[model samples]
Target: MKRPSRRRLIAATGAAAASFSLAGCSSDSGNGDGTPTGTSEPTTDGTATQEPTTDDGTDTGGSGEPVGADQLARWVPVSDAFEFDVRAASYYDADLTALAEHESDFYTGTYGRVAQSLLGAELVDIVPPESREHVVQIVPAFTIVLRTSMSAGELATAVTDAGLSETGTQGDATIFEGAVNSTQSTVAVVEGVVVQSFGSNAQNAVETVLAARSGETARLLSNNGEVRTTVDAIGESELLVVAERPEDASSNDPSLDGAIALGYGWQFDADTSNITIGVTYTEGETAEPSALASYLTEQDAFSDYGNVGSSVEGRTVFVTGDIATNQFDLLSAGTPGESSSATDAPQVQIAFEFEDGTMTVSHDGGDSITASNLSLVVGDSPAGSQFADQYEEVTAGDSVSVDVSNVESGTNVLVLWSDGRNSQMLAQAQVP
Candidate 1:
C-alpha cells in the first residue's frame, strides 16, 4: 500500500474527532446512569453518610466531596485475558452545567436536572468474548455517584421510572435492565453510587458490580507503575483516559506494539482548553515514538490545526498543547483517513480551470471530497493566505471554485483544502 499523505492523515483525525463528539452527544442522551432522565427527588433520609473504601482502596460515595484521583485510578480492572484496558472519568455536573448554557435542552426539565445532580463517574472497558472477534465488544462497567441527598432506592426508582424495568435485587441493590440502542444494559444503585454495565448481556453487568461490591476484583490500573506515572503527568485534568496495550498482542500498527501504555488528559477552562497525550514505549522501542510522531505529523489534519508541541523523555513521548475555545470546532471537523475513501489510486489529481481571475478546482475518485476551508499559498512560502473557510460543514461533490483576481500574474499558486480537521493540497496552478 502506498503511504498516506500528511493531508489525508489530518483529515482522518478531524473525522475521528467529529465521530467522538457525536458519540458523546448520543451517549450523554442515553448513557445508562448519565442519561438525562429522572424525577422522584432524592431524599436525604437513608442516604449513606460514610464514605466506604473498596478493596482497591477507593472511596465509593458521598456528596460535595469528589472521588479522589487515587480512587478513580483503582477502578480500572486489570486482566490478562484482554488485549488492552481503558479507564476514564468526568465531573458530569460541572461539565453539564457549562454545556447547558449553550445547549438549553441538555439541562431542561427533570432529566436535565437529574443529570446535573451527577457528581462524578468512572468507566471501565472489559475484554470481548471470543465469539465476537470481528466486533470490538467492550463490556462497559461504570460507577456514578450522585449528591449525598440521594439514597440508593431513590436513584433506582428514578431509573425504573425513566423506562428500564426492575428485574431483581442483587444483594441490597435493585437491578434494572433495559435495552438501550438495541443493547441490553443493567444498572443498580449501591449506596449512593449508581453502578451500570452496558453493551453486553445483562447478567455480565450485574456480576461485575457484584464483584466490585464484594471486593473480589483486582485494581489493575491504579496499581501499575506506568499508569501511576502517566496519571501524575496528567495532573488534575477535568477529563482523563488511560489505555494499556498488552505485551503479547499482535498488530500491524507500530504505535500499538511499541507503546506499553498511553494517557490522554483534557482540561477545559473558561477561555482555553488544553489536551495532552503521552505514550510510554517498551525499553529499546526507540524507533516507535518517531514513527508514530512522523505518522501523525504527516497528516494534514494536525499540521494546520492546534498549537501542538511534542517532546521525548527516555522511552516516552509526550504531546501537549492548548487551543482557544473558538478554534476547537475547526480542529475537530472531518474524520481521520476520510480522504482515502475518495480514491484508491496512488496519487490525487487536481484539475484546475482558470477563467478571467477565477479558478475552479476538481478531483475525481474517493468516497467524497469535502473542503470546508480553502487557502492560497504563494510559491516557496511557508504560510498560506486564507481565501475561504467553512465550519462543521462539508462542500460535498467533487468541485469548488475560488476567485483569485488579486493575484500577480505568473505566480505559482497552491490551493489548500481543509474540513476543519485535515487539509490537503487540492491543485497547483500558475496565473496566466
Candidate 2:
C-alpha cells in the first residue's frame, strides 16, 4: 500500500482530543485558525474549513496562525532535551502496565482523526507512551494544571500518574535536552493548567512550564525535579475542556496531595447518554477536588461517545463484530497496491450517509455500537473512501444507510458497506 500522504497524516494526528467546539464551552480564550488539512482539503482556500474532527489524534487540520517568536519558543518542550510533558496525574512508562483496564479508544481514535486533520505539520499529542494501558483515565490536558517546574524524569513520573495514555507522557517527555529535543518539541505544544494540593509540587511544575516564556520569550529550566522543563502558557483567559467521557466515575472522585487530577463521569441511558466531569478545583482554587464535577453539575454539559459507522459510494456504513473499536478498522483493509495483511491492520472503515459528514472509529473496537465514538455529521469529502474504497457523490438531503455484514472469513477482509452503484471500493473487498 502507498504510504499515507501528509494531508491524511494531519487528520490522523488531530483525532485524539482536538474537539475545538467543546473546548469553548469551558470558557478560556483565543481565535481559531481555519486551516483545513484532513482528507477533505479545504477546497475553498481558507474560507470553507469546517471544524476539525477529534480522533486521528489531532485537533483541526490546517496551518495554525503564526505564533510569535517567544510563543514559538514555549512551543518547544521545556527539557534540556525536549521530552514529553508529564504532569502530576499523567502516567509514565513504569506505571503503564498497572493501568490497562482504564483505556479509552475515544482518545486513541480521536487522535487518529487529529493527525489526519493537521496534515503536513509536525504533530504531537502532548503525551508519551508507544502503546496505552487499558484503564479508564482522563486526558491530562485539563489536569496538567502545571504551575511549577520539574525535571524530565520528575515530569515523566508525574505524567505517568496523571493520565494513563501517551499524550500525557508526550507532554512530560518534552524534557529532553539539546538540538534534537528542541526540534521534536517544536512539532507540537501541550500545556497544562494545574491545581495541586499542598503536597503535590504541581504549583512549582506549572510555574516551570509557564516560566519557559521569559517576558514572552521561551526559556528552558532545570527544575528541582532534576529535569529541564520548558515553559509557556496561553494566558488565563484560556478555557480548555477535557475530552467528553462516559459517566462511570460519577460517584467516585479521586484526589492527591500538592496536586490532584479530575475524573470524568459519563452516564448512558436506554436510548441516550451524556457526561459530567469533575475538575481539580472545588470552590475557590483553580485546581481543587471535585472542581470539574461541580462545574459540570452547574453547567449541565453533555458527553456522549456517539455511534461508529462508515460510508461508501454515497451512503453511510456500519461496522460490527467483536468490533469493539474502529468501524473502518478491519484487520485486512488495504490501499491500492497491497494485497496482504500486515501486523498492524486497518480495521476501521468509513461510510457516508443520512447527511453530509464523516464518521470515524473512536475505539479500536467495542462490544456494541452504543459504546463507540463518532462525530456529528459534518460535510462529506467526495473523494473520501476507506483505504482504497471508491467514492460516489451524494446530493444534499439524501437518505442513505450503511451496514457491515461480515469480513471475508479466511482473508480477514474489511467489507465496506455502501449505497452507491458502480464503485470499485466494494470490488476490492475479499468477499466469501
Candidate 3:
C-alpha cells in the first residue's frame, strides 16, 4: 500500500448520502517481495512489522491517489481474479480525514489516470476514523499483501477471522470489513472471467490493496500475517463459474448483489452497464459455455435492449433495455453512433432493474432521493452540488438503477436493488 502526502485534501461532501474516504495507489513492477527484513504476520496482538516510513528524505506519506500510469499496467496485465494487499501503516496522523484523504486521493488520482483501464471497482478508505487519527507517531508494522484465490464469501471470512473488521481498537488497525467494492472485476461472464467486478469501497479499502503485490517490500508484507492469500484452479477441461447460491433468495446472492452494486454498479437482466455482480466463477464450470442466456430465462429478468435481440439471439434472448424498458439505446449512449460534448461534464445516471429491484440515491444536502433517473453529468464539485444542478443537494436515498453512467466527483449516485435475481425493481433519479 502507499502512504499519505502533505497536501490540501478536502471535499464539501454532497451526493447520494453515501460517501467515505481512505487511501493508496498502483505502479508497474516485476513481482518482487518487499516484506520488511523482520516483518511477521498479523496476529491478535497485531504483529507484522511495516516497511519503515520514508525518513524525511526516506519514503514518507506513501504514493499519491489514483495510481501512476506504470503501476496500473502492472496490476491489470498481471491477473483477472480479485487481489488484496495487507498494508501496515504507522498511524502518524490524528486527522482521520487526512488519513482517509491521504489514501482516497491516491485512488481518486488513480481514476483520473487509469479510470478506463481499471479492471475492478476500488476502496478509497475503510480504516476506523478514530484509529487513523490515533495510530499516528508509532511506526505500526504495515503489511501489504494480495489474493486471487478465495471467493467473496471466503475473503469476508478471512478478514473477519483476522480481526481486521473493527474500524478501531482491534489493535489490528483494519476497518471497512465486508467492504465489497472494486472497479475492474465488475462485468458479466459466460465461461468464467470475473465477468465484471462488484463492490467498490471494499476493493480500494480492503481487497485490491490486499491483492498480490510486487517488488521486494511488497513480498515481505504479504508474507506477514497482515496479508493472507488463497488461490484455486478451474478444470482445464471446463470453466468454473462460482456464483453465490443462497438458500433464502430467488436471485443470485443478496449479499453478493449489494456488494456488487456498491462496488461496480451491476444491474441484472439485459444490463450491460451493471456487469460486475454475482461471484467469480469459471467459464466451463459445468458444461455451459454461457449460462447467461439460460440464467436470465430461469430468473425471468431477461428482456430486449431495443428489439435488437429479436433479429439475433432468439425468442428467449432480448436486450437488457427491452426486458426492462420500452425504449433503450445502449449503442448510442456508449458507442460512436452518439455525439455530445460539454464543459466539465461527468457521467451520472440512476439505473435499476424492474425484474430485479430498485436503488436509492443519497445527496449531500438535506434532500434524500429515490428514482431510476440516474444521469451521466453532474454540476460542479465542493460545498454544494446537484444532479446537473437541477436537484437540491442530497442527504440519502436509494434507486433501482442497477448500473450508472458517468461517475465523477460532486455527483450523487445510488442503487436501490432488491438483491434478488428473480426480483423486479426499477431505478430512477428525482431532479428538480
Candidate 4:
C-alpha cells in the first residue's frame, strides 16, 4: 500500500483542532527563493519583524499608539515550568493576501469563508503548575493577534452572533463562552486581537492577555531559548508547532517525555503541501526511529506515523514528508482507546437507522458462531439498559435488525460488536 502524505494525515486527524484559515489565493509556482508563491505576492524575507497593518492601513491600536511587533510577540508568557510553547505565523510577515490562499479544509461553505476574513499570528504556552500529589495537570494559555477589516467591538459582536454567549467583560476585553461536545471554551477580544482558551487555565488566559495589554510585566515566550530555537528552525512556513518537555517537568511518564523537544512546520502549495519535523531527545537518551513511530502510533496523536521517514543527525531526528490535496479523510475511523480495532478484523457490516423515535441496528456478513454472542451496549454508565447476555442466533449470508424503541434524539449511542470472546466497536451514531 502506498503511504499517505503528511498533509493528508494532518487534514484527516488534526483538522478539528488546528484549522486556521489564511486570507488569499494560492499559486503553484515558487519564487526561486525556496518559498512557494501564492497568487497575491511572493515574500522571500523570512526574518522580517514588522507588525502587520490593520484593515484601515494603520499599524496602530485603538488607542492610536503604534502596535509594535514585540508587543504582539510578548502576549504569551514565558515560564520555567512549562510542558510546551508553540508559536505560528503566516509565511514570512503576516501577508494576509498570500496566506488567504492556504485556507483550512475543516470548515466548509459559509462559515469557512467567514473565518478566512481574519489573519494574524499566534503564540501558545502550556505550563504545568505545582501540585501537592503526583498528579500531572497542564494549563494552556493563548495569545493571538489577528489583523482584520473589522474592529474589536465588531469582532466581539460577530462571535456573539455566532452562537457564543456573552460572558460579560474583563478590563477592556469582551468575553464569550460556549460548550460543544461536552467541552467548554472561552474567548476574549481586546484591541482587535482574540484570546481564546479552554481546559483548566481558561480564566487565566483572559487575564494574561489583559495584563499584557495593560503594561504589566508579562513573561514573554519570545524571550525563551526553546521557543526561539524552534522558530529559527522552522524558517519560512505557513504554520509551526513546537512541543518541549521542560527540564524540571516531573517524570509522570519517562518514556513519553524521553523525546525532550519536537518542532513541526508546514507550507501549503497549490496542489500539495510540504512538512518538516524535528525531534530531540534528552542527553544520553538513545531511542530508535521505529520506537518513536511506535510511541506516536500507540498514542494515536497522528495518523501517518508509519509513513513518516525519520533519520538521526547527531542527537536530533529529522523527518520530511508531503501530501497531495486529494488524499484527505481516507483513513480509518475512531481514535485510539476509543473502540479502535484491527483493520483485518472479521468482516462484518453494521448500520444504524433511526426513524420514528426508534433505532434499528442491522448486522450482516458474520458467521453463526459470531452472531450467537452478538450484543448491544449503550450509554457510559450502568444506568442505561445493560442488555447483557441478550444474544440471538444469526448465520452467515443472513442479516438481523435489532429495533431499540423509545430512543430520544440527541442521545449518544455506542454499539459494540462481540463474538463471545473478542469484541470490537461497531458504530457510534447519534439520533437525528
Best by lDDT: 1
What is candidate 4's local distance difference test score? 0.37
Backbone clash numbers for all candidates listed: 22, 186, 177, 5
Candidate 4: tens digits of C-alpha lDDT, residues 254-365: 3334555545655656656556565666657735766555444443224533356666665565665555422211122232223222222344455567666556655544
lDDT of 4 at 298: 48
State which candidate, 2 or 3, has the greater TM-score: 3
lDDT against the true structure, each candidate: 0.39, 0.21, 0.20, 0.37
**Model 2 whole-model lDDT (C-alpha atoms):** 0.21
- Candidate 2 wrong stretches, greater than 4 Å: 1-432
Query: What's the ranking of the predictions by TM-score, best on top?
Result: 1, 4, 3, 2
Q: Could you give candidate 2's per-residue lDDT for residues 127-186 as a string of tens digits?
A: 333332111111122112221233334444454443322233232223321111111111
TM-score of 4: 0.43
lDDT per residue (tens digit) for residues 1-432 in model 1:
012222221112111111111111112222212111111111111232333335543433322222221132333333321222222211111222233332322112322222322221111121111111111112122223222235666666667765678888866667777864443557665654455544333355345434433444433333344545555554555444444444443433555455666555555555565766666667887444456666555544344336767777776677766655433322233332232221221233455578987766555443233333544444222122232343232333355566668755544445444443333334444445
> Could you estimate the TM-score for every candidate?
0.48, 0.20, 0.22, 0.43
| Candidate 3 TM-score, true structure as reference | 0.22
Candidate 1 residue runs with Cα over 4 Å from true position? 1-73, 80-150, 223-226, 248-257, 286-294, 329-331, 334-432
Give the local distance difference test score of model 1. 0.39
Residue 393 miss distance in model 4 (angstroms): 19
Model 4 ranges with Cα > 4 A deviation: 1-74, 79-100, 103-147, 162-186, 198-201, 212-220, 246-257, 284-315, 328-432
